[model samples]
Target: MRAGNVKRGVVGLVAGVVFAGLTTFSGASAETGGCGLVGTVGTPEIGVDDTNAGLETLPAAEIALPEQIYFRTSTESFNRRWSFAARDGRIYVKEAAAQGGWRSLPLPGCMEGRIAGVSADDDEVMAIDRDGWFFTMDHALSAPKDWNWSTRYGTPLWTGAGNTLPAGTLDWTWSVLSPNEDHVWRDTAGNDHPVGGAKVSHVFALVDGGCRIAYVDPWLPVDHSYELATPANGRFRAVKLSTSASTTLVVNRFGDLYTRLYDFDISGADKVFFRYSYEDQRGLREAPDMLSERVDSGTAAIQLPAPDWVRQPKVPGEITDRISVHKTGIGSDARELRIEGESGGRTGYWVKQLTDAAWRFVATDQPLAGTRLENTAADHSIDESIQPSPYSYAGRSAAGWTATVANFDISNTPTTLRVDVGNGERLDLILHMVDGLRQLPQQRGIGTQARRFDGTVEVPGDILGSLATQPDSIRQFVTSTLGGRRFTDTAVDVTVREFRIDGLSVTLGRS
Candidate 1:
């Protein structure tokens, strides 16, 4: 995670909640609720319409206030009765009473300027301050008679579960919860079991513009388990993240939005294997194999529609800045997404339904025609190994012997061959595989019937003169290739067959 220059504030721990202009809603009245509890009831403050058009706009007078708000709803049964939103650094509580109106919740002095993000299930609300401090408020623990502000507010201690936040988590920009409850992992024996005997909720956050996740399991031990959740490509630096049961909405720094899906194939098995050791009398030992494998299916991140003018011809947009998703009751699938960003020097709000594939202007109700969004290409790599045989030459000549590379098999074509000798002496041969000798018959009676080819590289005259004078000098051979492809069995046998002295050839054993 990258560090930023943020104004850090100190948060004090207070024992009680502060009640200022707090309105109490009866449990019975809140129970007999209406449209607001399950989904958005009336017209939203900015984008969208009755027909569910994408990216529609409204006049300034008709535009609702509090343009920036973080509203969240959960699919949990106990928490499905209400929802919560954070705007202007203040937490607002809303329920079914009076057709679902929002009311400000009183905050203690310590929490007044600390809250940066808020999330709610039907039964409780959780908030994270700007400095990455976590706090939670439960309905049963706070207000039993009504769903209203309670005096009890603090971070959850998890009683005897022995779970705590990861150390050194100083600042996180944003946070959100997965809309669905946690599921159990299936074992190789076809048995389902929870991790640490408890189902867990995933809390994802942006730590210095990088995606990170932590497990929230109230009934289990969670220690030092916060992990990074960025994609393997490492191309997308997320500015915003909103998650559902199956899909997570990601907004990159370029203002392009993507829907990401995770596909994990987990398998585990227990097996017994034998190990051999010379020290043991029996010469073998039995060992247990605990096999565990986790594979990512590499699902492609699909880009969504953005403002028309922002994405022209073949280029991506850089205007989207904010995103909010709404999910229906009992179903953790995103139904609508509200996108707010700058377009043509003017800030605008755009709405996109999951069914619609394009963004439409809210005022005109006309779809924005533009090119489809594109994803970054995945990265690739290659590995190669080459081995060269040692050769020796002993002859009475001022000229050094010629070295030949013969009897080698290469899987891929190489562009250049590098040969390194001792004393800073080296030779590079540009390879032309098609022009080299191929399929020549091998020696008749030696091993199996086969064919062979040879490539020769001349040693420099200066290097040859130095080696001839110092016969005891160490000679080393190393070979490598240059190409963007894999090569296998690229080993060649090097032999000094002959030498040229005074423009006359002399065989290896000749004087």
Candidate 2:
């Protein structure tokens, strides 16, 4: 695109009150520089669908948005701060606060739990840690609803069954339970049954899909022979592995656990990895297999990876994919971006377009064409698709050539632009868009200046006609601000922590 005169939008946010002002022009400003375009257009009154012009070109400066999250006090768990979770349209979470007191609350819902993962509905969340245990107060615990319970911190009050763990296990402090999902996930060792009974090692949820419960072996099996005891009725099946996957799957007293899949061989290239965030010497090497294994005195605690679900390949879309939408970092089973082939049709890869915001999905026959640069009114987040076209500039309009650049012809749009950079420094850019496609020029504060080539002439009548016919089409407003001196993407790091204008970018609310 050729250099067209642009104006700054004069606007301000004072205590959230919107103030309208009349456009003021300087006699001298209208006579020089590149602001000469659209000079005569006085401040114009805009109609519905048009937002006030708020464009601004900030000076080269360092700017940062606060991602420092402020926490809300909780009535549950005694003011202990907790994190947030999202299920369906609702938020689910159990926070861990430092209030230093004990409080209680109902359990979180099943959206995030060992029983049922987040939503298969294609929704997604921010963090996933089977992280801590939570207790719920929302509904009185019955049969344990969906899996998440709220967090509760009692004084040094009851480190119940503390001796159960071999000194080094976690506080085993977090656990949550609601009606349909009730199971205590701990980082320590304990086997106190949720039903108020005793067994070996003492811990287990309705594992194996309510088919059986986990417990220690008779006489606490010396080598840690764990067992998945069958239900009284015995219609469903039970699952248990060698002491290898115990701590990875369940916590137990005496700091001990074993494999969830015993009798298995290591295959080539089939690596296994498990993660538990604990502060230690390298934070790598290995995590405590069972709570007791850390001290090396407990029964069989051979660390092993969990088993994978071995069902039929899904059709890329299903409710089983729900875990992704609710979990912060779990691979999704659903296909939000999937492309299908025609029956005996052209061969190409399938891609599913997730959301319509800064990201867009465009399809093509080539596996490469399936990806595109998506830009929209949502998430200002943009993806770096292709490197700057070094071959040639493809978005330029001729200065009165075949596809001529008429005085006011807005025929072509810019694909993107390379900002002018100086030295090794970078600059930052900010955008302030005005509402409504029309009423733009009037509200825009464009200072006029004489064109370097000519003094003046009758502006083409067709140019004014076109401006009037398609005012709204020019609705998008842009503002760019430079931070450092250079203009490199690696140099200019700007983070937009929040998109405050509610409803415009709907997904910003998620954690």
Candidate 3:
């Protein structure tokens, strides 16, 4: 993929991974008989893909005036999905699963010419004008013309005419509004003619994965083109989806549906990703507990699937460097885990929660040496193909113990040594802790105080008991002891002020 612009990265932490095609998306509904289904905080009033009642339900007959099709679930009872189309300055609602012509609402001053784009949920309806001013009306006979026009000063204009309208409603839902400029005109003979006719100029709705049309000339059934621009809602990937010129649609390296005809049946409800959900909670209307929220509902989870190493089984010695917990929703009770590391080899470590009873290994049986990496500060160039490497604990130690580990990097949780070993292996592991893993103190300090750690030691008898074992045993013993405590890279001055391994003093630093 060609690098367009660097975007923000989301962190996820999970074990199992699931992948499914993005089928249909629906906005949440409010209380019973309210504008819940159609009115989201930041979305357009649209319908979701209910495979039971697919897009084929939309009338195949071509519409005379400009129209946009979307879905809306009713709060009447069993949130029935209704196919809505804003056509010829009128809002038409029909059950997507059922047959019959669309039922038009009482347009009053809209049907003749006033309303350009409109969306409705249940009885609540919204309308836009040529100048981008907004107004709302309820179809309930009780409050006939309860028109509530917008008081906001932001005047939205034609899609490609250097002016912009609010991309979506404050309900966090998608919308379908026409531009101020007319792309279609009719002669006295009643023959519809396209203005600047080669291609059609269309309005765009920047959605989660890509962009879609909000408005297209009904007369011009030809290809609808668009330019790219950041929408008013800055959270979406498309900072902009405007037309480069007046009528030409620019195609990005990623082929979105903007280059095709603005057909909702074919494109589905292609609007902005609904930011409102049980977890994200940005909806204007209270979300009813209908179905479980979308899988991409949480902010902590990644939109895509996990990497190959995460899904595939581990191999012996093969270094499965670092595994990032990109997904959210980890239960609070899960304190200890056995994440498989490399496939096989004399490399691996264990993480035993001091509170937990048993010790478990992650990858190989042999303890792997950790590394002390120092980066040379230098400027780098951004490339299309390059991606930042995930954090890893696979490097060399200074003492030549073929193991590698880095201090804790929370963004990508690397493996940590947990179990204890009998020989010097465990000790050598503790030494790595001196680098980056420093546990923070609970008590508040006056300023940023560099902490000093002092812990008592007991040399094992196997290393010092016999002269024959002392030489080789001492070296091995130190390696294991230091390696085991390599949990933090804190500058710990491990001074032998009073060395007593099992209460025996070693004649080293006795000044």
Candidate 4:
């Protein structure tokens, strides 16, 4: 094997050791209040194999000196497991080797040179060229063995023209900036062009003046959609901007940190989903027909209400060294904000909740040690119902009587039904009757309105039989004997469209 080939195996081993040493030294130095003496550490040089055959490998030394690293949060495929690093205007990639350590992969031809910055999410890797153009490679694609500059990276999908920022934009500690794959566009020729992963929905950068934002309107024509704005009326001269999902953290030049929640009004339709119960009343008992109230329905974005910029309590005598915000997982709304600061040459760490007003000091050498952020918001509850009147059915025959329950024009199916029986037994049913509702073709122009469930439910024959023999009224029989049941739903745990249940009712019939 050539020198480069030999270095590939050796690099993985050495890189692991070097990283371990660095981590140990950092922890020790922080605990001892910077009393440790350390020699000058030189940047490790990577040996690039001249022969471009099979999977390319790099010297282990270079792996430790990355200016920035991008990690993919997917395990569906080998390519999705790949992680990227930016160093000296080039991109290096690695993945876990089946046997154990990390193995270097060839740099994509398009990402070989002039790579200014790189970021990744679960789906794709977004890169910025020296000329301010943006390129991306889908993480779902197979790993490339040899560099094919033209074929690998493809043409710059997003031109940075008119989207330029001030000097030092490249050095900003940005959070993962991935493209919004959910947004797509169609050309005049009717060709459906997927929204470029490089055309991120929002770009927050640290400019010379302060922090600036570039918002890309996915609905508008691509050439005319870039809109730039200053956040919080440019109140603070921001030195860093880190964004994850709906939350953003801003660090000003003076080391003061602030955070805010923001979400674009992508869809105009505002609808709410909830569950409700009806009390037994006389008027509804006299009626035997299906009753419903018409409600406006449409699709809308999921956003926690945006609040004013909230300043986090400062870390006493600490100079901010680095900051990061990460979502708990893919498709999660909760976030963790971690800050690393240095005081008197000793490293210290702090953590704050995304929606909190206080920052807690973490007495650990490692960042984010033992810290786990979770979504604590309560789920959307059902709170609507209709009352039914009392009706004695002592003389009526139970053989030909039936009961029907329904919820029409709903956004989502109720997941559970809790029945409180007179015998004090609580029965819970996992409703799957509305599963077919989602499979039906949706009506056009209806705006997310769908008929979830509208049919008779299985009531115990004994309950209906008792109605004929016992002197209990229909309302008493239905509520106490038949058992009072109500639909329950948790919006966060399930996919919810925008719309209220237009019609929810239960009807009794006698043949």
On lDDT, the candidate that comes out on top is: 4
Per-prediction TM-score to the true structure, in the order listed? 0.37, 0.15, 0.22, 0.40
Off by over 4 Å in 4: 1-63, 66-83, 94-105, 140-201, 216-232, 263-308, 330-333, 343-345, 360-511
Best by TM-score: 4
**lDDT score, residue 415, model 4?**
27
lDDT of 3 by residue, 269-292 (tens): 111211111112222232121111
- Please rank every candidate by lDDT, starting with the best: 4, 1, 3, 2
lDDT of 1 at 194: 22
Model 1: lDDT equals: 0.30
On residues 385-430, what C-alpha lDDT tens digit does candidate 4 reach at each position? 2112121111112333222222321222222333333344433333
Give the whole-model CA lDDT for all candidates, comma-separated. Answer: 0.30, 0.19, 0.25, 0.34
Using alpha carbons, what is the TM-score of model 1?
0.37
Full ranking by TM-score: 4, 1, 3, 2
Lowest lDDT 10-residue stretch of candidate 1:
1-10
Whose TM-score is higher: candidate 3's or candidate 4's?
4
lDDT (tens digit, per residue) of candidate 1 on 1-511: 1000110010111111112223221111211121011111010112212231211121112212232233232211113344455555566544322233445566544456556666654234556545444444544112323233222211231222122234433222222222123232222222322221111233444443343333232312233322333332233355555543323455544445555422111100000111111111221211111111111112111111100111111112223434555444332233555555334544444566654666542222222222222222222111112122132223332334232223221211222333333354544433322111222212311123322212223333354445434323223221122121212222232123422222223223211
